[model samples]
Target: MHDSYTEFILPFGSSPNILEEYTNASGGIRTGKLMEHLDSLAGSIAYKHMLGPGVETVGNTKEMGFYIVTAAVERLDMLGPLNPARDLRLSGQVIYTGRSSMEVVVKMETMPGEFDEKEETILLGRFSMVCRDAHTHSARKVHPLAISSPEEQMLYSKGEDMKRKRQTRAQQSLSKVPPNSAEAEALHTYYLKYGQEEELDDISSSSQLVSMGDTRVEKCMLMFPQDRNVHQKIFGGYLMRLAYELGFANGAMFCKSPVRFVALDEISFKLPVPIGSILRLTSHVLHSNASSPQLIHVGVTANVVDVKTGEEQTTNEFRFTWASIDESSQRKVVPETYKEAMLWLEGRRALEMGDEIRGLRTQK
Candidate 1:
């Protein structure tokens, strides 16, 4: 684990030009742009683990015989707000490894301030990377992780558990099976309360519920070669940034207020989007909490559009949670169709997990 450990520093505080590139409209660091950097950092960590730390260049893929690709982003949680006024450090190591896959956990922290001499963690994320044979384009074996300490052992155990949970969740995906009994009952209850047009039309109803379909925000753009990775394909990080920005916009539109990013619940890279493909990103408010400190779960799907055939193939799916900056925001999302209801339940589950993780952190 120590051999694979890596760190990169972004001097946002000291570099005016660098900070300017990352600044959002509101003067805060751009979370989506930060995600791109994190993805790149994870890739670097994975390579450093496979190659020696002293290796400076990847050289040639043909000579290396194997290449890495991001399989999925397990989760990225915001433990604290980003401070553009301070330098930031990104660091992580290869915590676990399978025959052909590596689990890399990366984190972002604010550098110690002049008055406060302790660094503060701001973000934590896990990236799943897979190695493929350069010639055969098949799974390639990766070096095993060396766990020497109890702390390293614990992290390895956690990574193993995460892989198992991912498999279980995939088996129980709504596309493959019906929701469990409790989720079905809850959906029925929600339908009775908000699915009926008559109930929603009643002026006496205090709930400000909006149909999930009404909260959509979309963008279509041509994928350029300039955005390609080493493989000459569209970079996973670029797709992540696009999905995140779309989700953020959808959340803000649904809440009618500026939103603070809470978490990137999950991202599945189904297929490698080719360069020059028309990329379409569609986002929707999948679920919402109307209580104070309103929370919204936004889902985004990225598709590769076939211009000649007028068909679209989904290449990626992303789930993100955002909270309204105004605690008084009280908008809620209601599903009008079975498919939408399933998405609502999935988003709810993601938010619940985020809440549980945050609760655990607070206890620590």
Candidate 2:
């Protein structure tokens, strides 16, 4: 009776008081966006566990938690168009371990309730999570004893098996895309437009993405808890936070400095993440262009899945733009190392779309 992930201790079989929990949201049972749920789940977990046994060691290590997704898979059964109800459960298990980074096995499912039917799996996936202590709120290190128990060893082994599969999938997704992928083209155009227009009113933001001179820098850390709503499973907020961190990371990567998050675009909680499920988070450099208040856009996608059931519990995608103020030259600059080709391609598509839209507008 042991939960297994990989490399590190998942800290299972231990009791530290359920940090959070979530249930089905119906008839206004839940309110607020998905990011809030992520916040609550992560907050509850950090408050209780990461801070345990060695409060001094775990103190203020938020940035160390920035998680990058490397792989994902979903079963996605065809419900067709029946009652059309769904359920979700999520799990995070370590699949790969580097010197300082690790990958987690993430999945999602239809948690049974109300209209929830039997034998339905919506999504399955895996992700890469890099643990570092540079950009977050404090010093960082993965808990050595985090999975030191005999029970944890088993979870770690399972995670290793999953790592091989997940790595395979990640490579396939990147290399095997269609030649004329509408999805890829659409993503490029959408991001370009999003980069141009989005403005922030949320003063909470300290900076934004405008440029990328070069190189890749790590940004944003995200955390998920085993308990979600305290009443039910997990909330959509976890999804949003994943997106936010992705944006934050991308923005910082572009500027090579800390970036503040101002706004999120078109976030929909297709599914809910559950407590105890591992979360896979990703932040990628999408596009960075134009000087003088340059703009850099980052994309965020999250997948949560069940560890025991091998089912998917959460899936969502979002776009984020981070901005910054140039200090030395008094002008914004974006470092464009890993993002050159992608950014150029995105710009080309956006330019095409703009031309088409303008052509249509003139016809009218």
Candidate 3:
């Protein structure tokens, strides 16, 4: 991937022929597919180029599952009037690393695919991500960054500046909650605090998974053979499709009516599943409430692992949430069992956390 600047014209478009498909009509080349294209590049670029070396050793193995920490970035550069037709380029460099987290410097631009001084910067952003141990599916410490280049040094300094600014803002914006603040504690607990060993749940256990009860859970196993790459890896979007499909069925079954996807509450991609691997998707009702328009929170987790390894290290877990709209005048005989009660507790906890986060964000 170090030489990817030339190799990766790279799935920039939705089709095999990005150049022909993303013709002059696609967002006038300034935005649109270009924006989406840039957005998709962050993870791949970070994993491939931002990391120093030995990324493969850290990525996946038999004992440790893959869960790479990810960072967020925003778009930069809007050459609105100047050279509007230019093909943009984005750049990222590994900046800094700590025991558990790493930061990368990312930039976007309206230039050719090549990386040169002439490749003027479009937008500049950075990310802080963490990689976790596979068996426990928990965040773990990592080696400090391995870069010693002048270019790396420069990027590291810039990333540190960004990090400081972000920390200051986060600190000022989110006020500390009092220990007795019920609303605050409920809303921020899962997010702000780590789960205890006893409290933490396993992904493979059906006990932790919600139940459809007597209702059926729908699952679709899709292998996009045509979408296969030389490395035999499946596209993230491909897996995402199967995931949402499974989630849609769970929601539809529970609602017993037409359902619509409202939001992606939380999503985490722990490891990369190969193209042919089976994606065992499970979705169950976390909980639901009677709002003016009812909101049902469904939890979907996809476990896709390499059957060849047959070890804890080969599996990748993805967790996501989908909210559905329940407009059915008719309702099914929903079961009120032990699992439902636990799910209700989890949902309640999530709601409180969300409320607190929003409160903190707004208080800014």
Report the lDDT of model 2 for residue 284.
57
Query: Residue by residue across 274-325, what tens digits does model 1's lDDT show?
Result: 9989999999999996646988999999999999999999999999999999
* Top of the candidates by lDDT: 1
Please, what is the TM-score per model?
0.96, 0.33, 0.45
> Model 1, residue 268: what's the lDDT?
92
Which ten-residue region of model 3 has the weakest summed lDDT? Answer: 1-10
The 10 consecutive residues of candidate 1 with the worst lDDT sum are 199-208
lDDT, model 3: 0.47
Ranking by TM-score: 1, 3, 2
Clashing residue pair totals per candidate (backbone < 3 A): 0, 74, 11
lDDT winner, 1 or 3 = 1
Instruction: Write the residue-wise lDDT of candidate 3 on 1-364 in tens digits.
Output: 2321211232333233555554543233323344343434545544554344345433443244444545333113222222343554555655666666556545555454333325554444444556656567566676555555787667667667766755653453323322335534543453233233333232124232223354435353655566542234555545545555566667666665545444334444556566666666666666554443455566666666455884433233222333344453223222244344444455544444444544674597
The residue-level lDDT of candidate 1 at 274 comes to 98
Q: How close is candidate 3 to the true structure, as a TM-score?
A: 0.45
| Model 1 steric clash pairs | none
